[model samples]
Target: MLQAKAYFDTHHHVGVIDQRIFSGFLEHLGRAVYEGVYDPESPLSDEQGFRRDVLEALRAMRMPLVRYPGGNFVSCYDWTDGIGPREQRPVRVDYAWKSRETNQFGTDEFMAWCQETGIAPMMAVNLGTGTPKEASALLEYCNLPGGTYWADRRIQNGHEQPYDVRLWCLGNEMDGDWQAGHVPAEVYAQRAKAAAIIMKGLDASIETVACGSSGRGMSTYLHWDRTVLEYCWENIDYISAHRYSENRRGDSAWFLAEGVEIDRVVEDYAALLNYVRGVKRSQKRVYLSFDEWNVWYKNMEMDGKGESAPHLLEEVYNLEDALVCAQYLSSFIRHADVVKVACLAQIVNVIAPLLTKRDGLLVQSIYYPIVSFAQHARGLSLVPALECPTYKAGERGDVAALDAAMSYDEASGTVAAFLVNREQRQEMRVVLSLGDQRFCEVLSVEVLGGGDAKAANTWEEPKRVTPRSAEAHVNEAGELIVTVPAPGLAVVRARVSKR
Candidate 1:
């Protein structure tokens, strides 16, 4: 039997959990916007053309924020074309996705949607193919409370009040050559610094995020991060990082272990930020915005095909993908200090947890972990010391079979632990020790596993692979014992009385 031990202390706090870390992203890619989230033609849509089914699905996840209007789509996008009446909104060729851009859904539509769903809007300004003046103008349009040109335009357009969006992205992946108007680190940094200065100048309350390397695999990687931070450090409040996991090699073990890679990325980026802070000798600190992340690899076939194909990037997630997603959330919880905000890239149809059809939607396997963590993993993050059995994976050698993260709620005295068992066959028995804290009772225990790694949900069968309640109990010695199945994710909540 595989064995693991976890120790959690209330005083050893990692960071205050940011609710925005449980955010989602919606882009104008594939069916994410037109058909997935806002389908006026569909019978299931609301009067305003918002898909009611999709809205309900998103509401269930309790997403705190939703990033809008782009991914690669923002790089070449003209924000002005998307505003005003739907019929008057111009249509352009989206060079990034090779699709026709219908500007029907713009900033106004997004704000309306956020209001309907009770989610905050995190907008991204177009840096590529757009000017800093335009970026500042867009900021003024959304934030300034009427009086100025853009602000008055917004008021005249329909919304009398401003959006007052707090979080803003400078650009999307400026380091990638494939991105429209992609520039070198120095050039992008200068542009971002200018935009940050202009937007913050317009409204001192808004926070800015400068684009870092697209992923760790980028040729520049940390160097891009360093250069961007060095140039735009004071102007920017957060630096952005984007990552996507895949199982191209068909190795389940290795694919699941890839979750640890995210942790490593966060650590390295945090270290880089620390080094930059020291080099600058500045008192201000910068946090990370993991604004775009998901499992995306199966749908690259139709990329660059242009308007001829509209639905090219819808990826169906599997059981293993869900496990990996849990690990990703666990990593975010573990590094809450540095990672203040994260948006699950494209939250509706394009590589998203909730997939939508014309009539309704399907909750993918990855959706359960997202719901669980978003609902329960709140309050202060705890640094849990863990001892577990090890396994040797191909490239990610000597990996821990079990990975765990814990959160403590002082007001309610609730302790929630998220555990993942990476082993393929063995059922690991876990012993959790809460030092100097008396265990009251197990509030809830849910495990997401049992199906094949490739198991997934379809339109016909939406509940094929989901989480189920597990058996957990607190022993006489104040230790909680639970068995974690292989290739599984478990979330446990218990009431604790402080001694």
Candidate 2:
């Protein structure tokens, strides 16, 4: 039998886990807005036209924050076009996704959804075809008290109180050639700096994020980041990073090793952030916001046809994809000190975890792991020392068969360990060591994966790929022993005491 050991020390910790790390994103592309979150025509929708089923799922995820308006859709978007009465709202062509965007669900609508869900808004402005003044005015409209022009306009739009949104993204992927109004790094840096100044001047409490590279695959990846930081490091509070993984190569082992890629990318960017701080010798520190990330290579074609709520980029996640998503949450927890915020590229329909149908929705396989970590992995991040067997995964080199991260909640004295077994056909015996801490009780041991790697949750079989409770016990040595299945993600929760 394959064997491994995971050692955890309650005293050694990374940092307080940011609940925003489990945050999600919602863009205007596809049915994420119209049909997914705001389906007025559906019988399941509430009085406000928001889908009750979708809101219930999102609320259960317990996401502290959610990014809104656009992934690429905000580039050519005008905030004013989305406010005021829906009858008077204009329908415009979305240049990014090549779809029709009705201004019906604008700033007020998004704010209403956020309020309903109790999730804070991470607003992104239009820096692509928009100017710095426009960015500041949008900030004024959302955050300022109703004495000014934009604030008064917001009040006239039926929202009397300010939105008071704290987190602001300057733009989306400014360095990507695919982005609307894409510009050189230097030009983007200057524009971002000016916008940051104006927005911050309007509301000194709000935090701003400068666009970093779209992904590490871009030719301008780190170079773009360096130039932007070199120019606007002082003005920005955080830099953004977007990444998406796929199994297009048909290599399962290499695909499962994506956690390696996520870890290295975060480390590299965190180092770059530190380097910039040193170069400028500034007291102000900027962290990373992995604002856009998910598995998104399967549905590369856009079938929108310039219509409303068209299907586009709706990638159905499978068992293998669930393991990767778990690894994503694990990596974010591991680097809690540097990576402060991360939004799972989308929340529903458009390359998301929950798939919505006109009648109902299917909770994809990826949703299990995401919810597991979001709900259980809280408090301090405990460093887990692992001695596990490794396999050579193509270009990723010697990848560990076991990927894991542990967290401890001091108030409850509970220790939750998130583990992923990467081997395809071999179940591994894992001995979880708590060192001198005494294991009090086993709360739960839930495992996901072990069936077909390509198995997914469809509308016909919604519960086809769900997690199952596994048996776990502690030995006389006080070490927890559990058998993690091949190609599986497991969450082991227990109460520990240091008597």
Candidate 3:
């Protein structure tokens, strides 16, 4: 087996890992909101029309937060349209996805679903066709106590208590022309500034996320972000980032090196945030909300055809995609200080980890890594110094064959390390060097890997590419040893104490 070395000290930590970083997203687009999560007609659904099996799977993943109501769908969405009686609700044309929205599952339904599933809701307002006043009104409806117009409306609607959603997005991808109301950076920043000011004024405790550049591929990427931050610096708490990696070239090494690309994106955004803060000389810091991110190039075609809950962007993730997903989690942990919140875009049937049918749920290959990381990778993120061989990843330059991140929970004396081997055909044996704190015993070692890179899971064969138990131990020399399969990822957790 190939050999690698990694060194870590409990003292040299990155930051406290925010549990929200292991979050998921749900959009009104495709089947994500309809048959995916909310289905009144399914036998698997609860009384509120939420899919019981889907909620169970999500709970198993340990997702703490879920971004709701939109992706591009919210750009033109009217929250009020979905609020009142279902019989009176109007069915509008969803301009973003070219589908029809029945408004059957609206704000109250979503909040109820979130409450039952134990996930915090992160909402996005419509800035495309909506006004700042409208944005503030929605905030008031969700967060304010009674006696006001919107709050009283909420009361009349049967909810006396406020939803009190803390995290709000000004808009979704306002810089993209494909969006419902794509505008110039100056215009978006102006609108965002107004919205944030009023929204915060309404609640004063809510944290707002200003829209940054849609993606690095945009011509106005950094420029748009700079303008927005320079405008909404004090009002907003975090800048929203959206990223989706594609295996366009069919190069496994380059595809697996997506983590390096993710690192670059985070670093670039962090630098931009710092620059804006310096320019404003502001004491208040803005972190990143990587709200929409995942491997999404597989199913780009949207075949909505005016249908409700069409199978749009329903990507069947392969083993390589799962490895890429692991890399994403590892990178998020490595940059836990800067990237405080991340949502795996669209949690069900829309380029998601869990695919839902009327009868059953299909857990994708990417689901295992997410579950592993979310379950064990918690508490303080530890910085690991690694010595590993490198492979050329095209424009990404020389990329390490081994990618890794570590987290230690002081309260539980638990240390969990997530490792990925990018080599296509060789297993790598890694020796972990712990300084001062020696691992006492191995808790569990699980590997998500298979011989075929393109292996995926389907309803017919749900466990086709699932994770299996692996071997790892604390050696007599006070080191930890584990062998990770090629083109695979592993999560090794152990009990630890000071030497």
Candidate 4:
């Protein structure tokens, strides 16, 4: 069933649009940082020893900013151990990844890799097993100009210059039991507040992300936000949120419902931010950094396997998962109004869109929508409200509908519409009407689909599930009716003439 809704407004200047929302993340969990992005022996390596193939992929996507060196791994990590000589560097157990942590690819390697990939670093501190003093030392090591002690030691380690990284995370996931030095909400709040203060005291130029509950479903979610903000309301520039959808329901309805839940997480955070701002009676707005997000379920059981065997976080993705990924990315752009920054969990090899091997990296089928959105959807994120058509997916709990977003770029004189259809076997002929103005023509249409909802891509056949163009056009009524395929994601670009 194809349904339609139309509305428009001009003055919705909601939030500061941070280009970092297009940013990706690189953690030391899987091959994401080590053999994934940097392998010295690879023939495709650049001068800095970063993989050229991976660099080219990132460059093509133009992922301008990224978070580095730890997800949960940041908790127990000692920044000092990995800074100096390669031989003297220690190899310890990575409780997070359950692998032997070789100090070979520490801060310096990451900074170099960031340079090669052309991404700014958003580093996270070790609040789990380390102290505020240790956090300050790392800031000095990375951002301070060449000087005595930390800066000089960075010089002695063969890198005479400072990295000058401007963004930092206070801690990884302080409220979660899985984190190494996990503490109570109040304890984490006090520690995160103190860390933000000192971290700011050390480098006022950098922006800090204070830890909120790891996700909305966490036991300490609400209290964690309130307590953390009580101490960090002023020092921190942004509050962080992390979430991943695990589809145990194994049906379209479950997937659909969980998808809405992810957006609800963002909605909840915005509300929390508003509440705190009112309580403090402060004018400063605390933005959100969704530094961790993606469709992850590959390593669920690996957690019980033990830390030394840190579950290899590699997730072999399929067609359904990729569609879910596209839907999530669309949600990010749609809500980019409040979400200043979002890191798509680990961007490569480890629970990611693009997979890498020794020979070269393969662009997953899911990578297209992300690339199109990231490159094209940079202009005004106009608030596009929709009366989404509903259906009873076996995830929506009887909520049947469509998920969509639109961006009108003034410079390009174009309107880009991203839409996803959740119901099985139903094509949506949505009348995309311009509520206030007129669009001359719908110039391009990119559609991603599958013969069956469960179809996917594999190593033997990479194109098993990919999007294809369909019958779509605009009518004289100035309404755009495009066929949105079942379980498909569509991007329509149009050029507007005049009133």
After best superposition, candidate 3 residue 98: deviation in angstroms? 0.4
Model 1: per-residue Cα lDDT at residue 242: 92
Task: Please list all clashing residue pairs in model 1, or write none if there are none.
Answer: 98-306
lDDT of each: 0.89, 0.91, 0.90, 0.76
What's the lDDT for residue 378 in model 2?
A: 82
Cα displacement (Å) at residue 460, model 2:
1.3
Lowest lDDT block of 10, candidate 4:
302-311
lDDT, candidate 1, 174-292, per-residue tens: 99998999999999999999999989999999999999999999898999999999999899999999999999998888887976899999999999999999999999999999998
What's the residue-level lDDT of 23 in candidate 4?
A: 80
Determine the backbone clash count of candidate 4.
12
Candidate with the greatest lDDT versus the true structure: 2
**How would you order the candidates by lDDT, starting with the best?**
2, 3, 1, 4
**What RMSD, rounded to one decimal, does every model reach?**
1.2, 1.1, 1.1, 2.4
Per-residue lDDT tens digits for candidate 2, residues 375-449, read 898899988899999987888889899998999999999999998999888888899998768677899999998
